[model samples]
Target: MFSEWKFTAKEIAEKPDLFLSGHRACAGCAPATVLRLIMKAVRGPTIVTNATGCMEVVSSIYPYTSWAVPWIHTAFENAAANASGIESALKILKKKGKIKHEHVDVIALAGDGGTYDIGIQALSGAVERGHDFLYVLYDNEAYMNTGIQRSGGTPFGASTTTSPAGTVIPGKLQNKKPIADIMVAHEIPYVATASPFYWRDLITKARKGIEVDGPAFLHVFAPCPRGWRSDPAKSIELSRLAVETCIFPLWEAINGEYQLSTPSKVLALAPQKKKPVREYLKLQGRFRHLFTPKFEKLTEEIQRITDERWQRLLRKCGMT
Candidate 1:
């Protein structure tokens, strides 16, 4: 028939519009774009469970919903638990001949707060039990849905409402939680770190994640214009810089086997040629405090964090 194979117009037309437009996401919100890309990648019957955060609050307002699929929203820290229950129920019903379906995919969505701080227990349990679902953490670095408070995902030297940068104290004193590494320690079927700047890479990884037979975790770097105080249009630029600087390396662990992606490969090939972390931090207001002369230590701290993380990743992947 066709010379090879491609996503024909008919096939594109047949893909479900799982996420609808007109939601209240801030301009240049990467997580919203992540949601779109993830939905496009998953091409089967799917149900979504959302933890209470920016995405859920915006997408499922009263008397309206931006979701085009079966979706449920729960408390700030229970999306994984809800998805686990839903997947279990679907399996039981299908076994008893109550429901006829070849595939029913379960997806759990949560912001960094829900994933890193409050919901880690639920996520760990779901992954340990090997639930057939995907857990995506849209890490905007702070609790953007609330008052721009600091969360476990917040990077060092970034000023937030709770972790203020003042004369006495620098921004956040701690580095971001190593979420992807934690998932890998669990030995999940798939664990990945991604950024919205690389849409094609993100989509490919998302497809692979959803197709995994057991648990999969995707930690996405989703920039927030409002919380980060960056130019709304620079969201994509910031995302790219994060990866290029090795502040957010792209990598994956499939059943404990690790491999670095494009950007990480470049870093590994020529570590000295990597982009400066300052070039990435200068774009965001959250890191503004680090630019001043007296805050030089903070800048060094941030760079140290980035380089250490990158080296650690290389070592784990055996690329060192």
Candidate 2:
């Protein structure tokens, strides 16, 4: 469904920059990478609504600002609703000939806590209303802004403040909430999953979202180093692993027709190319307890789950 969009990295560079340097995001933050790419693809007027999280705090501190365009930072759970309101007003303003912009795309940017849990209802309302806007969920997999607590988007067996590794329950009890699939179920004009690991693909998706006539949702897999307790420099590397391991498959659905964008080619011959989940787990302090034998079983189960999902997706895509 998204194959119609076309863009090259060189062309993206020629576009005007919306996100400049000297921002306050953590070192090697995936969200910042995605923001730059999104900004590069944007043309004409644009308004951004940011939920209270790392992106808000880091970009719009008390006395400083990092955004070059119009931005509003609302509470942690109402960014989508706020953006919808802005879009509605803009539609009226445009119809009245009060606004003179040929292209003005409104987008809501939120972290996992805001998107997957607290703000899900508001987001659903906005999309279901068929708002002419885009909602970008930057899935760092936890509430990274406020001490890295476990959010609904946290992956299974991953450790977090609320779901820490304990004697009874090892890490998060449930897997991720699969917010992308939920957005797809809304039957929007465009729904895609992308990562900062592939900046070109991310920019392409953003451009497509802007051109789409109706609601568009883009789920971004952003790796959190401080929260995940991993090396700050391995943000993109970890994100790539997430896709390769099937923990975060890149796919999309347009008007409820599902299509796999990046197939589970990495899982085609699992035995030969499988990277030990231990390597990925060991990088984070949350899964520290899983080094033991009993808790190691959880890791085994997670791998099996990921493998199974990849196999299932392959069949769905008719790649089997």
Candidate 3:
């Protein structure tokens, strides 16, 4: 029996070429990046349950599968439920001495729509039950697989097919929901927000999630170029912009205590000069209508909200 178990930072960084190249993720899908990074940290037998979304259709298109590890594509709202079943079965099998190892890591992967909106009930149930597994949410901020539709995780004032920015309502009106905070409220051992731009921080959180004995939820803000109306080449750059601009703050919750993953020094150096929200908004086809003076007013409103949120995070991190 193994006395202790944990993955080192270096070991986690040395991920093998498991997720083969030539997969069908969008030109710059963050989920693909997350899958590769997570595989590096996980050892022994592992199983993945993916929700019906972009990652499902792109990576596993029938006979042409790109996953080098074991994966299953479940319903759009049942990835967490399916993973729970798998974990229970593995536990029974191991107890009966039918399995070689004492532990089999199981993970459920889902897009923002599945995690924050549709699949939330199942996710809440699984975590509340104290299951031993991890749920990685690749939040592209919308229903990218179906089309550029608004999801609950999508930030306010972001245009989408469902939340169009017209003369009436200026895009998605509601602010982005704090799903990580909800998970932390469940009292899980680990809950974190990671970004593809921050690979080191991403790997660190994933490694910790796996070692956590109970349910762990990781909300990863992955940039979707096609959906977000941005250049595919600027995917990573946008990821960095999201954090530096305080649009997406990186942090973690360990047993209900929160810690800002980005250092104070890094926070201090954040761009005092932020690009106009229009610069970020106008690139996407969804927000094409938001170019007029009225739209400019909406842009200012968004900026104000972003500033307030950033200041709040600064206070939360004890930097204020």
- The root-mean-square deviation over C-alpha atoms between each candidate and the true structure, in angstroms, is 3.0, 2.2, 3.0
Native-referenced Cα lDDT, model 2: 0.82
Across 1-320, the per-residue lDDT of candidate 2 in tens digits comes to 33465667777787767787778999978888888888876756899989999988888876778888999986989988998889999999989999898668998899999999999999999999999887888888999888989999998888898898888889898988878878877888899889888677777778778777889999999998888888889998988777766777777666766666743354553546656666677777778878788797788888888777767766755667
Q: Would you estimate the TM-scores of all the predictions?
A: 0.95, 0.93, 0.90
User: In candidate 3, residue 315 scores what lDDT?
Assistant: 69
Off by over 4 Å in 3: 1-14, 263-265, 268-285
lDDT of 3 by residue, 228-280 (tens): 88788877877777776667878887888777886323764555554545556
Report the lDDT tens digits of candidate 1 across residue range 8-126.
44664467668888899999988898898788777588999999999998899989999999999979888899989999999999989998887899999999999999999999999
- Report the poorest 10 consecutive residues by lDDT, candidate 2: 262-271
Comparing 2 and 3 by TM-score, which wins?
2
Tell how far residue 241 is off in model 1, in angstroms.
0.4
Q: Which one wins on lDDT?
A: 1
Q: How close is candidate 1 to the true structure, as a TM-score?
A: 0.95
